[model samples]
Structures are given as C-alpha cells and as structure tokens.
Target: MSWTKKVLRINLTAGTCSPEPLNMEWVEQFLGQRGLATKYLTEEVPPTTDALSPENTMYMITGPLTGTMASTAGRYSVVTKSPLTGAVACSNSGGFFGNEMKCAGWDMVILEGKSPSPVYISINDDKAEILPADEIWGKSVWEADEWLHTKHQDPQLRVAAIGVSGEKGVLYSAIMNDLHRAAGRSGVGTVMGSKNVKAVVIRGSKGVDVQDPKAFFDATNAGKKILAENPVTGEGLPALGTQVLMNVINEMGAMPTNNWKDSVFEGASKISGEAMLEPRDSDGKANLTRNGACFACTIACQRVSTIDPEHFSVQNRDDLHPSYHANSGGLEYEAAWALGSDTGVDDIDALTYAQFVCNEQGLDPISLGSTIAAAMEMYEEGFITKEDTDGIELNFGNAEAMIKCTELVALGEGFGAELGQGSSRFCAKHGHPELSMTVRGQEFPAYDPRGIQGMGLGFATSNRGACHLRGYTVASEVLGIPIKTDPLETEGKAGLQIAFQNATAAFDSAGICIFTSFAWSLEDVAPQLNAACEGEWTPERLGEIGERIWNLERLYNDAAGQGASADKLPPRLTEEAVKTGPAAGKVNGLATMLPEYYAERGWSPEGDVTADTKARLGL
Candidate 1:
C-alpha cells in the first residue's frame, strides 16, 4: 500500500516522540494530505481554539502517493488553524520534504503543545528527537538551513525552516523547504513559531512499496505523458515558469494592478515571463537562469533565477545575504504580480530582489506585497502618512520603497512589524478596513475577480480564505483547460466553481501538484491512486471524497465563526468596476453567483451544508 500507516506524534511540551497507527477509516473517508490532516485538526483542536496557542495542533503530513513515482508526489501540507484568519489553514508545498517524511516510515508528523524553549526536530529513519535550536532560532531560512546541513553533516538532508519573520510572529510567514519551496499562506509558520519550533530536518533511507508496481508505473507514466503533451503544462509552464501568466492575464484585463484599483497594468509587459528571459544584467544573463522541478515532477515549472548585482535593491547592501547575488529560486506569476503590477512597480530586478528576500526570509509574497499595496492606497488617500510608515515613501511604483517594506517585513523590524500583520489587520488598524483586498483575513492573489466572474465566487467562498489554488477558475474561464466559459458572465459559474473546488480538494489530498489539473482530472488521477493504494479508486469516488473534504472544512469554519458571513468580496470588487481594457466598466457579479453556488453545493440559502448533504457525504 502507498500509506506507511504510521504517524509520529511529537508532544513538544513533554519532549516526547511516539509512534501510532494511522486511522485507516479516516484515511478512507478523507483520502490523504489536506483532507486527512484536516480530519486530525478538526478532531484534535477545537474550532474556537486560539490559532497561535498550544491548543492548536500542527500537521506536517504527506499524502498516499508521496515518496512514490507518481508525478509531483513530493507535495506536502502544513495544516493547522490560521492565526491570520481564525479559520482552517492548509498550506501546500512542493519539495523533497514530503517524500523524505514518508520514507522515514511515517505518513504524518503531529506537532502539538508548545515547547518550553526554542527547538528543532530531527528525524532519521525511524528515530526522531527534539534538540535545542538556540543557534538557528533567529536566523533567516537560508542561514538556518546551511547551519543544519553543516551540523548534521548530511548535504542531502531535507530541511523545512521558518525565517526571522516566522520566529518573530509575522502573521503571514511561511515555512521554506529545500531553500525556496514554501508552505506559503494563512500564517502556518506563525503557528510553528508560537510553538517555539525553528526547523524540521529529516533524512530517510527507507522506500515506499506500491500495491501494484506495474499498474502504478503504467498509470503514472500515462499521466506524465499527458503533462508532457499538454500545452500549458509542457510548453508554456516550462518555458515561462508561471510568469507566463503575467502578460497573458494582463492582456485579458484580469491582472490586479495598484492594489486592484486598476485591472490593467501598463508595465505588465516589462516584467513578464518574456522579459525574464531577456538579458538586462551587466553579466549578460537573463534574470531566469533555468527551469527547475519538484521531486518527481515532469513539467518543471519552477524558476532558477539570478538578480542583477547592479540593481539598487542589492547594490552595496552588505546586510543582504549572498543568495541575492547568485542563482536561486525566482518569482513565479503570483509573486511577480503581487510584488510588481499590484504595487505599480515594473522593475524586474527590484521584483527579483524582493522575491529573493521573500524566499530567504520565508515570507508569503502575496500577503506581504498586498499589505504594502493597501498601505500605499492609504498613504495616497491621506488616510495614513509618513508618520505611519516611519517617514518612508509608501507610494505606488516606488521600487525602492517596495523593496524596503519587503525587507522590513522579512526581518519583522521597523514598519515591517506593522505590515507583517497582513493586509486585513494592517488596513483595519489604520482605520480603512475597506482598503484591504482580502476575504476571511487572507489577501487575494494576482487575479482581479472583477474580470473573471467565476473567480469571484471562488475567492469569496474559499475554505482557506482568498486563495486561487482553492479553485483556480482562471484555468477554465480564461485558458479553457477543460471547456470554454465566459469570463464576464456569472451564468453557470456556480456549478463550475463547485466542480473545480471538489476536484481541487481531491488533487490536494492525493499528494500531487494542483498544476497537474491543467492536464489531468479525477478521471486521470484515480488510476494512479488506485494502483498505488489498496483501494478500488474511481473518478466518482474521488469526487465524493473531495466533496466530503470541502464540506468538512466548511463545517470546521462554521464552528470557527468564519463561515458564510466571510464569503464576501471587498467593496472595490463588488462595487467598483475595472477602469480599462476589455473588462472596463465591469465589476464582479458575486451576488448573482454566490446563491447559485450555494444551491449547487447542496447548502442552505445561507450557505450552510444541509443535513441531507452531510449525511450523503458522511461528514
């Protein structure tokens, strides 16, 4: 079977490491990864428990397909209640960490109770221990990672560590693994920091054994063939590395610019994927050095990039890490948009520098940039001033200012301390709650939902707040991945959003990249899962599991006091229309779509999962 069928329970309060059998019944009901971990969260931690307190448990878990030959099987999730949203937080990351965890003879690592002092977890094979992290606690992710590798004397050790931002309790901080891959969003790292954890370093030599290796190989190989043949997964993503969408979304008039006051960005082309390939450095190298991939990924959409040393963000900045000058992970499309067009800054080098800081410091670039953008809008409106920003020019398109804010947030110092609270709290504290472009206290990503109608519903109703990954309707509404749908029309969007959300939940639970959905569906995913695990998997069954997962998370939110009422867009999105391009004069019709969405989901008119629906899904 794909599952290791064992879990490592670490009670930091007791400094004890124990192993327990996994709940096979729950695994069958929830599948794995996001779904399974969420099951643990809902059962162990109270919905109203303070997200940063010892009562809130953390699940660093892997799915069934993890550590196997399945495409994108390296996926892992950090599941806990979010300090940012006071709701469920499940942030996924792609790296070698998930595989290592599974190979270490554990399907999940349950971290509960707060440690008395700063510490880190080190696991090798079946042995695990908690050790003092005094030397690495306050360091950046890169510094801590280097120290861990050197001390352990294992260059191949997979380390997931939070940077200074996380250690100091930046609300939107992330856990960075394999240097740049992050379990990003919804303040999971803040939870880890609150628990007094600094890092998790693992080295595993055991291997996974599938139920039917031949069947698994065939199914996985066929899946990889689909990815390699698809245009979005094979050609566009590999060539442009998700930064492909900067120009495409901008051209479609869906790119959020200037904190989403504008749907079109004039500087979009200047900082696009094509521009990333253009040589602008004194060394005559493009900002993008090459494409990289997560463990077992065939598409290889990750960007390995370098910043120009002459750029003002890095020039004479000895305080900056050396990673700023060399090749490292670069900005993807979302980071580019949030740090670039959303803030009105088109300087690629500046964006690259800020992106490096985000990776090095383990910050969620989406919330970090969106927070600064909100602050910029407030400053320009005279709602806030130089006094609020500590005399810094919080203006749109000010690359230096943007970089400064990013660095501050990374280190949790100066004005950065205020910005690190995330856009929702930052704006509300400044007395302009309407300026925050967030839902459920989490910032929206690059898309301007005003242009894409389905995404509005998706964002408003997202279980983990305003995240595109919860239901990336952009794939269907804009790219026509499965079928073409009108991006402007609200009609039929409800069912579409439901379908995508259900399918996405399944993908997340299956231990594969959601990017695989650009080419694969539950129909394609079922075979691989069936071949790997001891189950008779089918698309319809997987879909039911997905729906169960979604409704379960919804039920958790309802108890957490963030359900239904939190499913709303900002005044700017529902009231203000786009100002230019094809979406000019258009606003999101969330009101029209939300009710239909609820009805399709078999929820009440108020958006509560009905008794019949819960019974049908066995929730």
Candidate 2:
C-alpha cells in the first residue's frame, strides 16, 4: 500500500509525458529510491552508453518512506550515468521536493532523449506539462528558482533546478533544491543539462498514506526517541552541524591539507564549527545564525549562515545575490575542507561565500575546490602559467584567487571550463595524473585514506567513486556508533567496511538519512517498514537487500568496464607517507585489505560478482 504504483515517463525528443504502471515485481526485490531506480537504469541504458548522450536515462525517485512521518523522509535521488566518472550515479538530497513528488502520486519520474530547446517539467497533482524555459535557461539556480515561483505565482511550489554551470556543461554540476540543498555529487546535473531540462517544479495536495496507521505511529515515534537520546544525531549534529568535523578530523591528522600533500592544516580551528558560532568582530555576529530541518527531520543539522558582509569577498560586490547578503546554506565540513584546508586558504568568510556561490550556481564544491587545488599545484610547480589561468594568480592560500576561480567555474568561462572538467581530467591534461586525489574520476572528500585505514579501502572499492555516503566507516573508525575500531589498524577493516556498505545501502534505500545510522540500525528501521509497507520486514531481510543492492551496483560498474581495475586509490595516497601527527609515516593498507574484502563479499579474487553469490541473492 506504500507503493504509489505509478511512474512518469517523459521523452524530451518526442515532447511526450506518459503514465506507466510501476513494476510490482521489481519493487518487491529492489525496494525503492536508489534500488528501484537502478533497476530501471540497468534495463534501459547500456553500460557503454555515453553519460551525456540522450540514450542515458535519468530517474528522479522517491522511497517507500518518502512523504511519510519518517525522520529525514524528504530525501530523493537523481539516478543516472555520471558524465564525470562514466559510472552509475545516484546523488541523494533533502528538502521539500521529494514529498511533493510522492504526493503527486508518482514513485519515479524517468527522463529519456534530449529536448530541441530548453524546457522544464511542472507537476500539479495529476496535471503535468513541459514548458519552454528560454527566459530562465542560463540563469543561476537561485535566479531560476525565483523566476519559476514568480512566473507561476505558486508560493508553495518546490523546485529542483540547475544553474549556468550545468547549462554550460560543467561536468560536476549539481541539482539544487530548496535553493540550498542539493543532489550534489557525481555530475547528475550534467546529465540533466545534456537533456535540455532546466528545472522541475512540483506541488501536490494529495497526502501520503501507509498500510498500518497505528503500528506506523508506534514504530516512528520509537525511532525518534532513539535519535533524541543518541549524542551524535541529537546534540553534536544539532549544535554544530557537520562543520564539527573540521577540528576533529584535523586533530586526527586526516584533514587532507594542500591537496593532500600534508595530513594537517595549520589554520583548522579558525574555520571550525566552534568558530562559526563565535561572534565576529564586524557587527559582533556569528557566521552561523541558526540550525534548520528538512521535512520531518528532528535532528536539525542543516546550517543557516551569513557571510561577514565586511569581508573582502562580499564587500562592495554589486552583483551578489540577495542570499549572500543574509543567512543561507552555510559551509558543511566537506565544503570547508575542500575550499579552505585543501587549498590552504583558511578564511572562514571566504569559504562561506564560496559555498553560497556553489549553491546558487549548481556546482559540486568538493570537485570544484579539489580541481582548483590541483591547478594551484600545477601553478606552483610551473607546469602552467598565469596566462593559462586568465591573468589570475592561481596560488594556494590566496582567498581572492580561490574566490575568482569559483565565480569563473560557475559561469563556465575562460579558465573555468578547464577546471570544470574535474581534477582527474585537469591533472591528466597537465601531465600530472598523480596529483589528482580521486578514485574512479570523482574527488575524495575531506578524510585522508592514510590516517583512516578503512576509509581508504572504502574509497577504493566504492561503486560510485570516492564518496563517504556510500559506506561511512567513519562512524565506527572515528565516532564509534555501533562499536569502536582502530582507525590506524587494518586488521578487521575489510569486514568493517563491508558491514557499513551493506547497512548503508539499506538506510539510503529506505528514504532516511544515514546520519540516523549514528543511532538507529536496520533493527530499529525494520519495525517502521513492517508496519508501513505490505510485507514482513525483518532486519535479516533488510540486510540481504542491502547486500543485494551493493552487488547490483558493483556488477553494473564491472559491466561498464570500471571493473576491478578501477577499484584503486591514487598513487600519491598509496606511495607517499603522511607527514604529521598520529598517522605520521603511514600509507593506506588497501592492498592488504582488498583480497579479504573480496573474499567476505564472496566475489571472485578479480572482484566480479560470482555465480554462487548471484544465485544466493536470487539476482
């Protein structure tokens, strides 16, 4: 009964939007959101298909718990082939959009073929239309969002849109929703732009219903209690947001400073969560104004922040968006690390300004900042000249240079186009492939593989490229959610990584935030699903489903030729030793862990899903 059993198929080339029945059989096997959408992608698009081509299909999907009272249930995923990695991409986001989509009675929206001109999909309950978007096509996400709302005069409308970065073919463009929240990794927005789809606006009046109302209430309320009691999900996240990790990771010697040449940053504390709360000298205001929540989210980890108006980045800037002048989406840990630490900038206001620009213009800050870091390395090495950077001095620790690169990339102009292709391509072009700290063409987040041993293996074997969300060993290795593990020791990390990977797949598929995993396990999740969904949902069954999903994504990547060979860390991580603190003189033990990981998963030594494993999962 939780299943809407509806699909919206939009063919941009033919200018057709048709309704189709959801495959009930697939739904039973794969569940919903990431898992269900992947099943559609595998059937429709071939492994060899060009990610930016019309042949590569895109799925905008909601899970079974979506539009429900489940905590963090507003999450949705943009599933497609990534233009940056040429691998399957599923980028999740939270805001009001997913709930609206489900309320409109659609479980998924599939896009195929390219439009002759720029267009947007607007849905109001059963009514849906494709409208010309010429006026807003090249605008920033903020500009486009405002234009759409004013044009339609629907104050309640929820919009997910791209910006000039997406429209201009920036490979790492994001799909921004709620003006700030994003499906922010792996270039999902690039694929959207390739199809000439600029935005999707939705408004739904039909409310969501579950199978067992009384049991659903009991299950959900119990889950909320667990979150409230847990320290990480309750106090830590709510008080500091994700920026809390800035000082913690730095102290651990895993901060990945100056493009990962060092393990620690000298200026970590100045850009930390605690610092965000400290009153600034100018107007005595803190960078963080307040905490916020997505639909039904009680944790309220979302940060609302204002840049120091007197800071050089924003001072006297006449072209700044109104959001920059006031509180907006603040810097998360990854964005702060990439823009500040990795580039050696360390100016808090500059990082905040860059983050706002990223949201406004639909760019992935991880890729954007990491790419510029690589460019800075090249400039310092004299591999490239100031002429190549369009007269801007591309130097590490120069906040002005960092800000300039950000603005240029948002517009996809001049030197920005080169940087927009991501660090892998940029480094390769400059004959320094070793300089790009990436796995499968996607930039790694803040954690250094050398310090956090399991994370290295996690990044290497991650199906979606160097992503923490896919499987966060950090919970155990660092925060010790379920149990504490040695962050330096590689003894049991293979098993640790596998467990996290499988469990995370379940969490992601169930339409809940992985942050909830800090307190709630699948055992906690099973009661809610068993009541809300039609079938029996034991922890055992959910575990198997998570494992099945992991294998499915792995098999798809293998078929796409990003096989076992692509499962590797960069040379700099494997060859060079970290220079400071607890992890001094250490390198990642991925080689020692890879074989054990393969054996635990019951895959072949070559890292392909075995016939026996496939039969066991009934794949």
Candidate 3:
C-alpha cells in the first residue's frame, strides 16, 4: 500500500515521457531503492557499456517506506555505471526531493539516452514534460535553481541538479539536491551531464498512504524512541554531527593525515567538531551556526556553517554567489578531514569555504582533497613544478592553495581540469600511480586503513570503490555498537566486515538513512517494513535480501572487469606503517583478512560468487 507501483520512463533519445507499471516481481526479490534499481540496471544495461555513453541508464528511485511515517524516509539513490570507478554506482542522499518524487506518483524515474540539446525534466504530480534549458544551460546549479524557481513561481518545487564540474566531466562529480544534500560519489553526475540533461524538478500534492496505518505508526514511533534513547543518535550526532569523529579517530590513530603519509595529524583538534563551536578571533563568530536535519530525520547530524567574510578566500570577490558569503550545512567529518588534515591545512574557516564550493559545484571533496594531497607530495618531491599548477603553489598546510585548487576544480579549468580527472588518472598521468591513495581508481575516505584494520578490508572489497559507508566497522571497532572489537586486531574482522556490508545494503535499499543503523538493527526495521509494505518482511529475510543485493552488485562489477582481483588497498596502506599513536609502526593486515573475507562471503577462493550462491539468491 505504501508503494505507488508506478515508474516514469523518460527516453531522452526520443524526447518522450511514458508511465509504466512497477515490476512487482523484482521488488519482491530486491526490495527497493538501491537494490531494486540495481536489479533493473543489470537486467537492462550491459555491464560493459561505456558509463558516459547513451547506452547506459540512470535510475532515481525511492523505497516503499519513503514518503511514509518512517523516520528518515526521505531518501533516494542514483544508480548507474560510474565513469570514475568503472563499477556499479549507487549514491544515496537525504532531502525532501525523494519524498517529492513518490508524491508525484512514481516509485522510480529511469533516465536513458542522450538529449539532442540541453534540457531539464519537470514534473507536477502526474504531468511530466521535457523542457528546453536554453537560458540556464551553462549556469551553476545555484543560478539555474533560482531561475527555475522564478520561471515556475513554485517555491515548493524540489530541484536536483549538477554544477559545472558535472557538466564538464569531473570524474568524481556529484548530483546535489535541496542545495546541500548530495548523491555524492563515483561520478554518477558525470553520467547525468553526459546525457545533456540539466536537472529534474518536481512538485506534488498527493500525500502517501500506508496499509495498517496504526501498526506503521507504532513501529516507526518505536524506532524513533530507540534513536532518541541512544547516545550516539540523540546526543553525539545532534550536538556535534559526524565531525564528532574527528578527535575520536585522531586519538585512535585512525585518521589519514597528509594522504596516508602518517596516521596522526597534529592539527586534528584545531579543525574538529569542538573547534567548530569556538568563536573565531576575526569576527567573534563560530564556524558552525547550528544543526539541521533531513526530512523525517530525528538524528539531525547536518552542520549549518559559515565562513569568515573577512577571510582571504571570500575577501573582495564579486564574481561569487551571494550565498557564498554565508554557507550551508557543510564541513562534516569527511570533508573536514579530506580538505583539512589530509591536505595539512588546519584553517577551519578555509575548510568550510572549500566545503561550500564543493556543495555549490557538485564535486566529491574526499576525492578532491586526496587528489590535492597526492599532488602536494608530487610537488614536494620535485615531480611537479609551479608551471604545471597554473602558478599556484602546491604545498601541505597551505589553506590558500587548497582553496584555490578547490575553486579551479569546481569550474573544471586549467590545472583544475587536470585535477578533475581524480587522483587515479592524475597520478598515473604524472607517472606516479603509486602516490594515489586509492582503491579501484577511487580515493579513500578519511579513515586510515593502517590504524583501522577492518576498514582496510572493507575499503578493499567495497563494490562502489573505496568508501567507508559500504561497511563501517568503526561502529563496533570504536564506538562499541552492538559489540566492541579491537581496532588494531585483524582476527574475526572478516565476519565483522561481511555483516556490516550486508546490513548496510539493506538500509540503503529500505529508504532510510544509514546513520539509523547506529541504534537500530534489522530486527528493529522488520516491523516497520512488514507494516507499510504489501508483503511480510522478517529480520532473517531482510538479511538475506541484503546479501542478495551485495552479490548482485558484485556480479555486475565482475562482468564490468572490476572483481575480486580489484580487492586491494593502496601500497601505502598495505606496505607503509604508521608513524605515531596507538597504531604506531603498524600497517593494515589486508593480506590476512582478505582471504577470510572471500571465504565468509561463500565466494570461490578467487573471489567469484559460486554457482550455489547465484542459485540461493535466485540472481
């Protein structure tokens, strides 16, 4: 009853929009959102299809729980082949835009083929149209966002668009929505831009309905109560956001500093969550203004922030958007660590400004910062010169240089154009692929694998390239969620990584924020799905569904030429030992854990899913 049971298929090649019945069979097998979309993609698009070519397809979809009373139900995913990783890409985001699509009578929107001209798709309830985007074609997302709002005169419309980075094929470009929230990873936006489509705007009045409303309300309320009672969800997140991990990770010696040259950063505390609250000497204003939340999210981990107007980054710049003078919910732990510690820049305001530019221009800050750090190493080694960087001095601890590089990449010009190729391509082009701290051509996130042993395995085997979210062992290895594990030990970590990966896939498919997993498990989620969706869903079944989704993505990637052989950490993480902190003189034990991980997944010793696995999952 919660499902709209409808899909809107927009064929850009034909310039037509048509409605189709949702495939209930696939939904029954894969659930919804990320899982269901991946099922559709594998069935329709070939694994070897060029990611940015017209043969590829993109799906913007929501789950059955979306637009309902379920907390954090306003979630969606963009699923496609990634130009960055050349693997399966499913980037999830939180915002009202997802719920809006459900209200407009679509469970999923499939975008395929390339447009003859730049255009945008507009939807008002059931009415959908392809409209020329001539006036706003070359504009930034913010500029086009304003123009669309003015053109439609609909303040309530939800807009999801790409910036120049996406338009110009920055390899790690993102698709941003509701201004700050992003489906941010693996170049999904590059595929969107290659299709010559500018944006997707929608507005709807049809509210969602649920079967057994009383049970749905009761289950969701119980879920919310659990979140409110948990320390991580109720207190830590709402107060400091994910940035709370900055000091914690640094103290544990798990923070990647200077692009994994070390495991500890001296300036970690200066740019941490606590520091975000400290009043700056320049204007007596703190970097963080307050905390915010996505639609239906009680956790409220978003950081609404601002930069010092008098700071050199924004000083006397008139060619900037007025919004840049004030920033939005930016500078979370990943962005801060990537642009701050990894780049050796401790300037919190400068990091905030870089984060704002990332949000505005739809660039993946993790990849951007890691790439810049690699370039800094190259520069220090005399492998790169000032002439190669368009005259900007490339150095660690230089906030101005970091800010300049971020601006250039956002616009995809000059040296920024080179950096836009992502760390893998950029490093390889400079004849130093070893300098790139990446897995499967995608840059690693903030966590240093040498310090967080399970994360090393997690990063190595992630289906979407190097990412923390796919399997976050930190919850157990650090915060003691469900159970505490030793971060430095590699024993029993293969099982831990498998459990996290499978469970995370389920959460991503169920139209909920992965942060909710901090407090709730599949046992807690089963009741809500059982009540709102048409069929019964148990915790056991949900776990199996999660496994099915994982293997499904893996199978696709295998055919795409990214498989078990691709399970690897950068040499720096696997070979180089940390210099200080709890993990001093220790490197990640990836070699020991990888074989166990493969065995635990029921895959062959070579890491391929066995015939029995395919039969069990009915793939």
Cα lDDT of model 2 overall?
Answer: 0.92
User: Who is ahead in lDDT, 1 or 2?
Assistant: 1
Q: Please give the distance, in angstroms, between residue 471's alpha carbon in candidate 2 and its true position after superposition.
A: 1.0
Residue 471, model 1: lDDT of 92
Location of the lowest summed lDDT over 10 successive residues in candidate 3? 321-330
Q: Backbone clash tally for model 3?
A: 0
- What is the Cα-based lDDT of residue 159 in candidate 2? 99
Error of 2 at 258 (Å): 0.4
How many angstroms is residue 420 displaced in model 3 relative to the true structure, after the best TM-score fit?
0.5
Lowest lDDT block of 10, candidate 2 = 24-33
Off by over 4 Å in 2: none
lDDT of model 2 at residue 619? Answer: 79
For model 3, give the RMSD to the true fold.
Answer: 0.9
Which of the numbered candidates is closest to the native, going by highest lDDT? 1
- Give every collision pair in model 2: none
Look at candidate 1 and tell me the lDDT of residue 103.
87
Whole-model lDDT per candidate: 0.93, 0.92, 0.92
The lDDT of model 3 is: 0.92
